[model samples]
Target: MSQDRAAGGRMGDSSLLRRLNHAAALSAFLEADSLTLRELRAVVGVSRPTAEDLLSELLAEGRVEETAPPRQPSEARSAGRPARYFRFRAESGYVSGLDIGAHKAMAVVTDLRGRTLATHRVELDPDLPAPERLQAAVSAARSTWTQAHLRAADITGIACGVTGALRAAEGVHDVREGPFGSSLAPYSLPGFTEIDVAAELSTRLGQPVAVANDVKLAALAEHWKGAAQDHRDIVYMFAGHRAGAGVLIDGQVHQGRHGAAGEIGVFPMLGWETAVARLHARGAVLAAEQGIEPGREGELVITSAARQDPESLAALIAFTEALARGAAVLALAVDPEVIVLGGGMSRGGAIIAEPFRRELAKLTLVPLEVITSAMGADSVALGAARMALDTVITDLLTVPGS
Candidate 1:
């Protein structure tokens, strides 16, 4: 019996090693567009036979495929036969992300590499009931996968970004109780904490769904592919209809014990609560002067400021000054490498950047490099897609039946 137990342990050890090798090889392919057998062997630190075996397994699973090697320069080209190459089948599976906000519900379907294949957006009424709002979000996601010409089953992962702070517990109420409740909830949707957002979306979409605060996800998106890609520590501020912040420490998003790490806007003393109102008030005046509808006051103000309208520019400065107050608090606490301004208002370009930076500089001890988001309105959704892609990769690397 002891001999049999020892033999079982040896077999288990061998299986673990094989699994590790398989994961390493697949990870290499995922990182690069393509790889040769020799390169795979070196990357996985395995024998030629083991690399070939791993490749066969991946090929059988349709997660990898043979591809033509790139043509080399005439002088660098070898005289011998060319090496064969294999590439990860990014199209073998898909992932999706959803941004459910007060104004709209946007969804994007991406390949395994987080490339957006299709996106769909639906305008939503903030006053819509919780159940209906969730349905709308799921429908948008479904539309994206359908537009990508893929079935629901083809999507291996899904993540959604929403307005309220998410707790660490699985099904806890997301809405805060006091005056500090979700900023957008009063103006947009109601009773957001009444339902299990992830569970409801998962049930409707027929897949597991990961949910996070929209601002935090926007920060993640910026780090992944936007303005902060070069920086490891960052402060992402969402300056749109509402003001919020997301923090990244050492390249990882910092979610506090309650998953509300960067919620500085909740403090009235911080001035974020009044920032957007100031912008809207200025925008309303600009819209009236321009003879446009009043509801788009924010856009009007931003555009007028860009054109160097004196009143608009002054109002923008005031708005940024208010924004700087909250940002200063975050900067003092985190000391990030950069502060990235994202959201709808960031589209103001230099009109927004200059004042925001000028104001932030006055309030902080260190001169913070403030940049506007290049991702614009799509940052949150793209960030959500990154979250989904991360989930997919995690599952891919995991050994089956482990």
Candidate 2:
């Protein structure tokens, strides 16, 4: 190689290092918007000159702004001038998060700072073809897009949470994998075996799109802003229409080989779904025998009935036992720091938490905290939003040009 070319390649290494440092500084600010020069240097772990150069590059890119006051009081006291404080400009772009299920689809719009701007939901005809349901989901997302006052092209990217396993190889939702139970099929048409979720959304909205398993996204949501926030190892179970689980190992969702890591419900020995079915059956029988109105949701009916009739109460305890059995099995294998109950059944916190925790305590030597989901039905969508936001931010930092 020529001397000039070899020397230029060496210069490129330093240039690349500076670009990486710039991205790191921007990321630090994104985590918590305001920071002083010293604080930025400490967080980014760079020399004073390197930190200043990185910050200057971010400011020039219009990603960082000098603010009047530091968010942390100590930073303000340490740095006399308010101009020393810098904050990330969060409003520069946005992302779309979508949750698609058998019955309905929901969408949430979030800014670069990961704040929800608007949300939209649309019901699907359970008997309708899959393509129609997909269209409905797209329409629902567009409704939120309209609410946010942005065209489809304005979005940086999209993340979608769907009802079945993520076929990463195909970039589609593998609808054949039934997490919601075999009795309940996913929203799909006869002709389409797999829903090309990423391609469809990206085509419809004019941006890159990504897809993930719904339960895993829900677990991610919990880790980000729910009961599992304090714990890195978590087993998050979704016990709504059917029983499903998502595992988090070391602050990351653990989707094992074939994306079937948490298919614990498939083993009938665990008895989580069986217990749920039994509870619903017993509730229906009791309602008919007593001539009382039965609640539509099995979870609500079971939990509410537990407060009344002795049989229903016993069934609730049994349900907890089964749930604990499944959880204990997972805990023994992975030793999660916490186990979270999410989805529809989790809304019945009082009836589920105490018994489940008590039974879990009996089964496992290593005690684990059990709690209900705080996000309710919105967990998957919110988690999808987090993923969407990450892609946008990743591109912002990693791409060659803004």
Candidate 3:
């Protein structure tokens, strides 16, 4: 019995080594696009025999394929005819990114490399039932995938960005349901109270779907591919339908104990809720309710009106000040290098940026910058994609022999 147990341990050790070798070989091929046996051996730091065995495993798994002889990077590395090269089958899997809001639902399909394969957007009827609205989001994903000439089975994972407070233990809570007097986001319908939105999307899409706060996701997008890319630590102020923030410290998003770390807008002293209330009192909210559109429309009206009327300009400045005041608190706490003004109000161009900077300068002695978000509205969805992409890659990396 002792001999049998020892034999089993040896088998397990061999299996583990083979799995590690397989992962290394596959990763090296992906980084180099394609690799010959000799090059792969050098890249994975494996012997020729081990590399050959790993390649055979991958080929059998349909993950690597031999293609036409591409030009090699170096010559005379080996003393034989050029060996056949193998490339990763990047098409073996797909991923998706989704942005869900009361106003619009958008979906983007991407290959394993996170390249945008296709995208689709649909205006939603906010008055619709929650399940129907969610289905619309799922349909949009399907449409995008179909446009990419891919099927449902091809999608390995999906990530969604939604307008709400996402708690780890309880899932998401839409801001509209909170005690705030003002409707900050374009939250048209009554929202789900305590639903596992990620699980819901995953069930509907037939793939793993992860969910995150839209503003938080937007900040991530900024860090990953937008203006905040230059800085490792950033405070991204999301001024869209609602006023909030997404903080990145040391290149990772900081989610507090309850995922409410950046919910500064809820403070009555900061004037986020009051700012919108004041704007609504000035007839901006009326325009939105009167079928003018949601999100950016009210801001545009405010922007254009501010240029001509003193009241509009004063209101805008007051709102901007409130936004800056909230940001000052975060800046003092995190001391980030840059503060990115993102979300709906950011689309106001210099109109929003100037006032925010002026107000922030008055409140803090910190040497910080206030810059407009270069990512615009697409930040959340793209950031969702990036999050999803990172997750899928990590998941793949963890799988034995992947």
Q: In order, what lDDT does every prediction score? A: 0.81, 0.75, 0.75
- What's model 2's lDDT at 129? 74
Native-structure RMSD, model 3: 5.1
Off by over 4 Å in 2: 1-12, 36-53, 71-82, 167-194, 279-295, 310-318, 399-402
Work out the TM-score per prediction.
Answer: 0.89, 0.81, 0.83
**Per-residue accuracy of model 3 over 244-315 as CA lDDT, tens digit each:** 787899877787766666767767788788776665555455455566654454475566565676666766
Find the 10 residues in a row with the least total lDDT in model 2: 183-192
lDDT of 2 by residue, 1-402 (tens): 432235346666655656666777887998885988889888877777778888888888888888867345664456454447888987677888898776678999888887888998887655657677667778888999899898876677788887664534434355464544551222233333555666776777666678788888999999988887888999997767556788999988887666667767667677766677777777678667667654434554665665676777877778778877888888889998889988877777677678878888889988788878887677888999987887677776783632
In TM-score terms, candidate 3 sits at 0.83
Better of 1 and 2 by lDDT: 1
Q: Point out the higher-scoring one by lDDT: 1 or 3.
A: 1
Off by over 4 Å in 1: 1-12, 167-175, 178-188, 281-295, 304-315, 399-402
In candidate 1, which residue pairs get closer than 3 Å at backbone N, Cα or C atoms, i.e. clash?
126-188
Q: Which candidate do you rate higher for TM-score, 1 or 3?
A: 1
Better of 1 and 2 by TM-score: 1
